[model samples]
Target: MTIFRLPTAPRSLQKDQPIKFILDSEAIDCLAHNIALVHPVFDVQAFRQLALTDIAALGFMDRSAHIAAALKATLPAKFADATEVLINTLTPPNAHTERLGLGVFFYLPHTRFVAEYGRDHKHNAGEDPFDAAMRAQYELTRRFTAEFSIRPFLMHDFERTLKQLMQWLDDPDPHVRRLCSEGTRSRLPWGARIPQLIKDPTPTLPILDALKSDPSLYVRRSVANHVGDIAKDHPELAFDLCDRWLSHADKELKWVIRHAVRHPARQGNATAIALRKAAGGR
Candidate 1:
């Protein structure tokens, strides 16, 4: 394994603080070491070389994917087995999913691993790739947001994937429920846009409608974001949905509807403004 000495913060900051921003060499060492512990045959030294080489040039997410590529090289070619190793390495999640600390960033590369390689199309494992990928993502989201990773699967088999998402609307974990909306977002920032959804975002409405009244504010916030994404391309659909949500709008639903229409209301869409007002917004 690489001897990862912490990168010293430039002389500008406090002397004792090391720059621990993105996945630095130390992060890779730690991640690789964890994987080694779970999968005994994992070549930790090789992963170090692959993940650390040229890592300085990459940005946050690129660094994540670079490390994932390294894992893809070292781990078992069987997708299910590889993801299982990652699942074993997760720090057990607690009751609260919303305000977890920065430590969740440790799994960023794990999400990337599932995103890039989850769809094992030419499967030698005799199991559906979608099943493996979604299962992995369901686990991954509890540890770290799997919103980005789920996009590829959504694009691969829209209907098949969406069926599962619909079922997840009532998930016990807020993260899983949130993923039902967030993962299907039409224009999720930094996520692959689902063009079909953008053209007719109506498909996502049921998921939002199910979640608009979610107990967790964490889940409700994502519902708002998903609705906002709808508003961007198809304002009519969004306005209509907000209008319906207004029928029994409580404080939480009102907040979600207001946020869902915020941008459009600002852009002077009369319908959005009307919906916002109806939802008791300013």
Candidate 2:
């Protein structure tokens, strides 16, 4: 209920100072106020604004990870509607420059929140403001993390997350369905890549299988991208999926298959070439 004010600009100019820089200072303040009313504990505006500064400060002190862990422990849970808020709020593609810093402070933490709350205490029901705020934060965190750069980190948790997300493909919510694909994209640009999925795409097949027919463009785009990521290594497998799905005679499935197999087609791989021939391309 209380407004979480954005932090004052720093006295010294550092590399991280400009990471969260908004040309429209007043707009950032206004947005922060709005988020505060909906979920006060998610006072991330200051953190978002000062992300580079915090990390810079941490780096200078040789405590970046320590600071990150501390913030994770301290930051309040997000608002439930955070995803809706972010989807409707779009920044310019190149806005917010301290990419890695921004990725770590705002986006990475959100991924952890989703993995934690969305997977762990997801069903916990309560009217407590804190609980509501945490859930909201988790959702918003997830939506925001989608914009971060993900690298292939070999971890047991990646497998667990992929399995859980694959099941979410059946979720009725379009957003959750989209996350199922988007979260696992091999080359998700700014997202962490699931190495196992990239090296051996079998884990992602089920998620793609469930989402191939998804009506939401947002969800389908991710499904296409997930398959495309697979095609980077296993062109044959990607072509096989395209062959099977395209045979279904559904326009949407065709579209997804086309997008998914685009990379292989560009590479002139035999499977992709065959798919193109079968799809009536000369």
Candidate 3:
């Protein structure tokens, strides 16, 4: 039910700062304010104090989890209602596929909140947790990457989640479209692992096929990484897909194939090397 819109200008010039610094006390203050704007009942003082206590020792992800805990403690008890507040807290969605800066990292705790506490089969008493969480990610992905949060849904309900992802292939936002491929990636670093996707990777082939020719390079790059993951597990499947794709690949598709095979090519796999060479070598 969310419509994502990207910003027309760039943001965040401080690329060298530590990633963890993005979620410092300043972040907590701002987050508390944002939630208060949308949720009249949110206790900004309680949320801030709770989120920031003894937080200097925590790392980036730990701080995110800690804030998520604070949000869970302070926000509405019902998952559905809480998700609405969190969604309202999100900034304007990013319209462009690339150039989104560290400003996007502000939502790490938001997505982390969804990933951690919202994993129950039915988070809300009566509402379908999958629907609630997916809707949040569908909008949040535009503001921040939802690839990490979405893995839990894939693990909990592969069929329903994959079906939803399939429907999103034609999404107007490039970020949403890219999520369809990146979220299903079996070997996604820092995300939940799905042994089924690692062992087979066939279920996602339809997803890959749908996105292989996508106009957005951002989407194609994610698809390439997905195939690279598959290549690690099922080189035969990966090789065959690349071989078949090469039969009629355009310049963009060719680049995807090359980048996808680079991992195996580094190890000197003959077919991988051959494929890379045929794709014109990155």
Candidate 4:
């Protein structure tokens, strides 16, 4: 595994005395392995929070993908310790879904990782870290690939994965269906910019079309974001998407459009400005 090290001190740490942070054995092992080459001093708790926050911040850059890959590689293969740590870290207030968003950011490269660790019928659902890992893995992996990676492959042999993801859109589980949209978002946080779709986003039309009216607000938000991404590139399309579905969209979808178009709107992008105006400041 590549060694990832951070600078011996961050700006904050360098200014203050070194604050000792203790980590449990599993987290310690994971951090040591992952950070061995990375160089930053990690206070166990701080590092974990950093990981979660970084995961949520994926849309900004490719940094989270590096963290996710390093995180998986560094963790002890045995789940006994890691599972407890991960579960304990879960707090509703923290927005576990944001951590899940990291999955989309790191999805394409982690395909192999997910196939190796994702749910297996053989594994029973329980305290098993493997199962939790699998569920978490799929939540991040499948969704991201379905949402983002789907477009890249459409022009070539990628259709297979795309079709498979579409099938997952109809999954019995709401999480899986949500993945179908969230995974494919063009402007998803911490993910790559979908230039092709950005220029002409017809590729994602079907996926967004399928998810536009999904029962889960979770799934629908992604669809809105996916369309909003396209809108940045082609505002007319975004306008059409919103105009066609305005009645069906809830507040979440509107929020996504506002966020995704913020930059373009600021840049005086006529399309986004028009959509912004049409939306009537809601």
- Who wins the TM-score comparison? 3
Q: Which of candidates 1 and 4 is the stronger one according to lDDT?
A: 1
Candidate 3 lDDT by residue in tens digits, 221-273: 99999999999889999999999999999889999999999989999899999
10 residues in a row with least lDDT, candidate 3: 1-10
For candidate 3, give the lDDT: 0.86
Displacement of residue 124 (Cα, Å) in model 2 is 15
- Cα lDDT computed for each candidate against the true fold: 0.82, 0.52, 0.86, 0.48
Candidate 1 structure quality by residue, lDDT tens digits, 1-282: 323122222433334643345478777878877777778899989989998888887887888899999988888878888888887777665568655655667678889988888776653265667777888888889877899998888898889889998988877999899999999999999888999998988888889889999999998999999999988888888888888889988988999999988998899989988888888887
Model 3, residue 189: what's the lDDT? 82
RMSD of 4: 11.0
Q: Estimate, for each residue in 9-120, the C-alpha lDDT of model 4 and write its tens digit.
A: 2223233432221112233345444443343332445446545443433432244244434445444344433333332322222133334422122233333333333333
Model 3 regions lying over 4 Å from their true place: 1-16, 121-123
Of 1 and 3, the candidate ranking higher by lDDT: 3
lDDT of 4 at 217: 66
**Best to worst by TM-score, what's the order?**
3, 1, 2, 4
Which 10-residue window in model 1 sums to the lowest lDDT? 2-11
Q: How many backbone clashes are present in model 3?
A: 2
What lDDT would candidate 4 get against the real structure? 0.48
Identify the superior model by TM-score, candidate 1 or candidate 4: 1
TM-score of each: 0.90, 0.59, 0.92, 0.48
